[model samples]
Target: MNPGSLLAYRHVISNAGPSDAAPVLVTDTFPSGVIFDSAVGADCTGGGARCTIDRLAPGDVITFTVYGRTDTTVRGTFVTTATVASPAENLYPDNNTATAITTVRIFVYLPLTLRSYRP
Candidate 1:
């Protein structure tokens, strides 16, 4: 990734339980050095800061695509995290959270000045 460049990320959430999971909510906070842009998916909302998914069901798999741009001065490693939860107890909570990392490099150009002297 490069500074001022657009970046896209995807998050997948699945209900592996035998029973349905209702009123599910999925959230992802924008990582530092990146500005939120937009997202797409079912029941998806929120942009320019975070993303949210409103519901899910047993054996349901949902994919979310989030768009963002790298800050003009951003560099180094950036990590983004997403989590899924519901008021109902999750039989397996270990897979509720996911994370992704990206490296950014910025290129800068400087002008050179030259002068000639006569003896």
Candidate 2:
């Protein structure tokens, strides 16, 4: 990704339990050099980084997309993490958290200086 460019992230959550899971809370924080833009799916708030799901039935899957813009002056590797939780205990806890990393690069060009000499 380049500086000042848009960066998008997608997150998918599924309910694997046989029974319905309670309301789920999904949260993500903008990484350094990133500014929140927009989000799709779920009731997103907190600068489009937080979402809440009323309920998730068994075998139900939900997807979310978050958009952000890179700071024009910032360049480096930015790591963003998202986590999901439910009021009820999750049968599988190992997959509750996920992360995405993005690297921003910028290139610069300089013109050569020339001088004229007279004899």
Candidate 3:
């Protein structure tokens, strides 16, 4: 497939309210072990005050274009960790801690075509 035609997308699924929270996207290539791109707090997950496929809530889904373009096809690992803030009544109100990571899902989105390398 045409690398330019392919785009990367992502979303954060949670069971809480005010889905306005921000989401971060990180991409890492395998074998070579490299991070091609990393976007922090990208508001591309919902449409308004939201971005991506749709307005997502708990069990909802969304998508975004993380890699707008590429010259070749490669394999990599995508790590998604949802940084959330706990309520004041919770044990730990601050969501910056490790325990606050609510949802994390990883998968591979392949382009329409694959590029081959010659030995």
Best-performing candidate as measured by TM-score: 2
lDDT of 2: 0.82
Assess every candidate by TM-score: 0.79, 0.82, 0.24
Full ranking by lDDT: 2, 1, 3
lDDT per residue for candidate 3 within 1-119, as digits (tens), equals 33323334343334343443233232222122212242333443321122222233434434433333333342333232233332212243354222111112233486697789998
Superior by TM-score: candidate 1 or candidate 3: 1
Candidate 1 residue-wise lDDT, 30-89, digit = tens: 667677767776445555334445556677898878777777778788787778788778
Candidate 3 local lDDT, residue 28: 23
Residue pairs whose backbone atoms clash in candidate 2: none
Off by over 4 Å in 2: 109-119
Better candidate number, 1 or 2, judged by TM-score: 2
Return the candidate ranking by TM-score, descending: 2, 1, 3
Error of 3 at 16 (Å): 4.2
Off by over 4 Å in 3: 16-67, 73-119
- In model 2, the Cα lDDT at residue 79 comes to 88
Query: lDDT per residue, candidate 2, 1-119, as tens digits?
Result: 56788887898999997777778898887787777777888777756377888999989999988787777777787788889998777778889999998777776667899999998
